[model samples]
Target: MSASPLKILLCALEPSADALGADLMAALRKRCPEAAFIGCGGALMAAQGLESLFPVDRFSVIGPVAALQALPAALKAADRLADLAEKEKPQTAILIDSWSFSKIAAMRLRKRAPEMRLIKYVAPQVWASRPRRAQKTAELFDGVLCLFGFETGYFEQAGANTRWVGHPGFQAILAHDSDKAAFRARHNIGAGPLLAVLPGSRAAELKRHAAPFRGAIEKLLTDFPDLRVVVSAAPGAENAVRALAAGWPGGAFVVEGEERFEACRAADAALAASGTATAELALLGTPMVVAYKVELLTELWARAVLTTPHVSLVNIAAGREVAPELLQRDCRPERLAAALAPLMRDGPARRSQIEAFPAIARLLAGERSPGDAAAAAVLDWLGTGKTP
Candidate 1:
């Protein structure tokens, strides 16, 4: 390894992606400690000394309405990021998730500094929907790093240099993320059924999921009066969570910030909005019922192009319905309650999820740790590492 630092540009658009970026940065630093990280990300990556050109939240938004409103700012940030890359001329630029923002920056970087090794850190779900994006990604980046084993064929066939680096978060979760009893004791939660509610992290998610989610909790409370509810809100969505919880009756505890994980660990089962949270719950060995409700327009759009059998990562990874899914109109409060009731009491669905954990773990685990592989791949693409 060289004593001289390598200036590597990295961008992460959301908390999950920021986490992956942080782990990758740590690994890059271990092999090359003086490496300088620059570009956009959240607190986690900022702690790794990332010289962010803008706040990571500037790039976070979901749904057509929110995305439309945020477009101008998002474009300005992407152009600014590309300008930063052109000015600094980093050896490489690794764009993590947030396909919307990353692709724009990638195109801009290619326009100015065509020689920079532009790597797509996490491939988008093109195989599931909008398959044209595979060729689009191939046209933009020099290489692609995939998080799942099954994703390689899509990018490879599209003519992109791709590698399955596994997911660093999965390894981190399995290693240190579960502590059920401690969570219960800290929150004063009893052995009686504890249901976790994870609405979502983004503002749009809060707006869409909060009301219906509250209705579901209320429905459950009527039946299981002793049941304790812990609403685990995403980082930026705490105020929204509190606001929604205020209208609710007794027994629902709202946990946010770092203390939020306590909700996941403390829960008997979870009613979660479909996304990465479902996978996290599965990794925690907690059974969950996943649901999603987008605007009718988006739902229609999703139905038109969606190829995947299930939406939640746990079910997707299981290659079948490990956790029951209720989407669109089916995500009504009554339906949500119906689906979640069994899991709260260790029903068949819960047992099936528990039994499926080992397989999910094996499917996601990398031979080497995720960070080690991600760092090696990035460095190798940059023509630097002395091979581990």
Candidate 2:
């Protein structure tokens, strides 16, 4: 008798998915060495043997305005993914991030082939806000592989098979501690307290966050005169971030592209614009203060739709106010400086935050690894009677 092949189709619809998708493919391949991977991804995924139909970056957008602008392209990409699924007819399909687009694509795939098993790598944040979405998971997704443990209950209650698979970013960070001094030396950074500032990854985010962050840096510099600052510029954001902080006193260093993680791991503390970076900073064991500054129009839209008080994942996971969060009107220079100053200076507070890091890691960690667990779940759904 011949052995059956584990045919899997994975869709990566976000920029962050570029890293996470690649990491997942590598992990899945190790466990099920003969499994085949196809569908949408970026450069990293391509390197890991994922056959992509289109560039994931074109579909990786944030904010309502940007989404509206990119909707036509996103719809077309969804159609392309649907076409690939029909032609390929894999045993199971996995969608990673890019919730809006991925959900649409999954719907299309279901319409075409009702028996195909579909799994979502990251669940929507319905627990914090949009509680109704939790009840609607069964409409689109068959299974959900969650990064946070609390997310499982929502999906399970909604009748979707859910798994709390650990986060790949946390796993990557835990594998090795990047040498702080060596990293500093490589960047020509001198002996001084390092403060890493991550404004954001997109153009609109940079516009809202960069100036306010620079303002806070100016205020903090007055108190901590010996402070050294570095801005981890997101990929495709080098020139815009530099322009935003043009007239600063001490100036700042910019680490563009994939080097942002290295800067975060090396910094003493971070004043990051609220998003996934907060979770990344936590895994890197870097104490950070989260802040957000959005356009008036954007704030108005988010205020009406946002479901939770805290925006940082670290606070969401800890189920309390683990770190100070400054958003909207409260994200002023004086306020940010006050919140971050002590986090940079106080040894005990920093240590306490570091001490709580393992618990957060444990909450996000799952069987084998996120990809392997996901792969196993996918294989089980296939009913092939084979181990992953």
Candidate 3:
């Protein structure tokens, strides 16, 4: 009989990738039950039955400064992953996000198993910053799965085998309805125009934003005494955001993990630190002001690399400033107040924002769920012998 079905390696380098990786693995098993999946994932991926070689949390780092500090450990882990891919000789290897390190890991894997197919789950935001990375990605991986519709064109232009697999976040939000009353009751929030504050998920992100976000919280509470401040507490940063908001009049509350989505859905407006949360807020139909803060040196370096005018994915995808963005030094408490006041207060601005939600949702709905589309593309590659 034919040799046992090819072993597929699913490598995840960050926590968020954990969920995406699990979904993909489940789809793969359903599509080809005989195929084996070697797991490189966080807790979520492990729960999906992926054999974990290392914890993904250790590898999660963003921004140039933070990455530099973690470079040694990151390199060691990447090397270990590369060696595993080489020894295993898997038919195909799937590398999820953590673009900075994943790209290097992909290159190393390609060198180790020239015949093995390398699939990149989430293409880097090359269109936003390093457009040249697209060429590098095409050279390193056999195929790429993009989460956004606009990414397909950018990747294809670089001669990469790419597909827009849709953002799983979109599918997730669309599938789940917000339990507004239950959510408010559970959080002990008095319902009167809640303003959700999402500082960001990364530690470095929290350091830069938590303080200013607290200031914004104080300002909102001062101006609108009834405004309930609900913070979407990123995993591991609950206490940090809370500590920063010490001394606030009304006091702030934290919504951890997935509960943050529910809080976002229930909120009338939000002041979000620019990142993935911005997109999440949009999907929840919450009007928001996007802000970002980073180290002075990192910001200076980023200015050289960042090509996009807007950092928030909502604004980037919309091709216009759908939500106001206050970045770096501009992310002051007063300025943040000015930016968010209009979105939260009654008038034409709020109506305009509310009106744009449908179009945004429609744009996000264009692509298939990330897991289904990625699994289908991988299965096709398997059939065509284009991968491995």
Candidate 4:
């Protein structure tokens, strides 16, 4: 008789999480070819053989206030996930990113299916904000697969079994071997100055950042007329990205879908929305100015909880200002121009960012592959042999 397939209920609520889930699913499949997945995920995981119980788009909104606005929808998604977990009774449930939604669903799942081994992929930046979230995580998850090494110890201290799995975001950068010159040539971009503009992958993020990023570009255009612009359009954020990219004073080229990383590789510098792409920018050794804007109410409360001095993960890992982060009013066009101008050209700020990449890569890429490491951790938690 054939061995029973390991049943996993995996939930990923954003682009970054979806990609991680896809990678983990592949790694797990190699070990347990008959493993079946049931939960929510995007195209990548679906392609990796996850036929989700519901669409992934339902849980897309991010950030504090923005996430609050989507609470009703998010709650519905969370409830449905809990219901699925109760009915399916998967041996394990791996909640990837999306803390708010994951927390709600996890809590309910634990109550409904106490036997399910709950694992959380990508620990929250409790080191950055909401330190007590570690305690909350301990209460919610049986195990947490962390991307950073420090996170493993931090959460372990909080009474949860957490493992260091490096970071898939940085690994994506390390694995990608794109030729900048060829990429630039293909895009018909001259070497004088190429700017990569990333206004984030979510609708709320694009809505908040597109105008300021555009204004910054316009401001730079006055000083550098020959500057070439490439906007990194997030998958599923096409219309929003087009609306924003279309308005750039000096025409901007949009790179979406699979080509986004190529655009990152070709850019001289980037004005990016503070997220996973920052890791890619750092991996490509590109100088960057990270910008983020949140609703006033959210920013006000976030400041209180946020303990880290830097916002960009690259800088956070480096323990210094590798990439300058402009948040709230500091993310204004004039301030953004001031921060980005030096990066667009060769300067100390830009050089510092470049110097920081190797360490970031080293810190993120442990001895083993991040995706595989995360998968092994999950399998071990499931009492399944961790071998393909």
Q: Against the true structure, whose TM-score is highest? A: 3
Off by over 4 Å in 3: 1-4, 38-90, 184-191, 201-225, 361-368, 385-388
Best by lDDT: 4
lDDT of 4 by residue, 238-326 (tens): 87788878857656988887688888878888999998788778877888999999998888887888888887777777778778889
Superposition error at 292 for model 4 (Å): 2.9
Question: On residues 283-375, what C-alpha lDDT tens digit does candidate 2 reach at each position?
Answer: 777898899877788788887877777778888887777778999889889999888887787677688788887777666554357777666
What local lDDT does model 4 show for residue 382? 66
Report the error of model 3 at residue 306, Å.
Answer: 1.0
TM-score of each: 0.76, 0.80, 0.82, 0.75
In candidate 4, position 252 carries an lDDT of: 90
Q: Which stretches of candidate 1 lie over 4 Å from their true place?
A: 1-26, 32-93, 98-116, 168-172, 201-225, 247-250, 361-369, 381-388
Candidate 2's TM-score? 0.80
* Candidates ranked by lDDT: 4, 1, 3, 2
Using TM-score as the yardstick, the better of models 1 and 2 is: 2
Q: After best superposition, candidate 4 residue 358: deviation in angstroms?
A: 1.9
Q: Is candidate 1 or 4 superior in TM-score?
A: 1
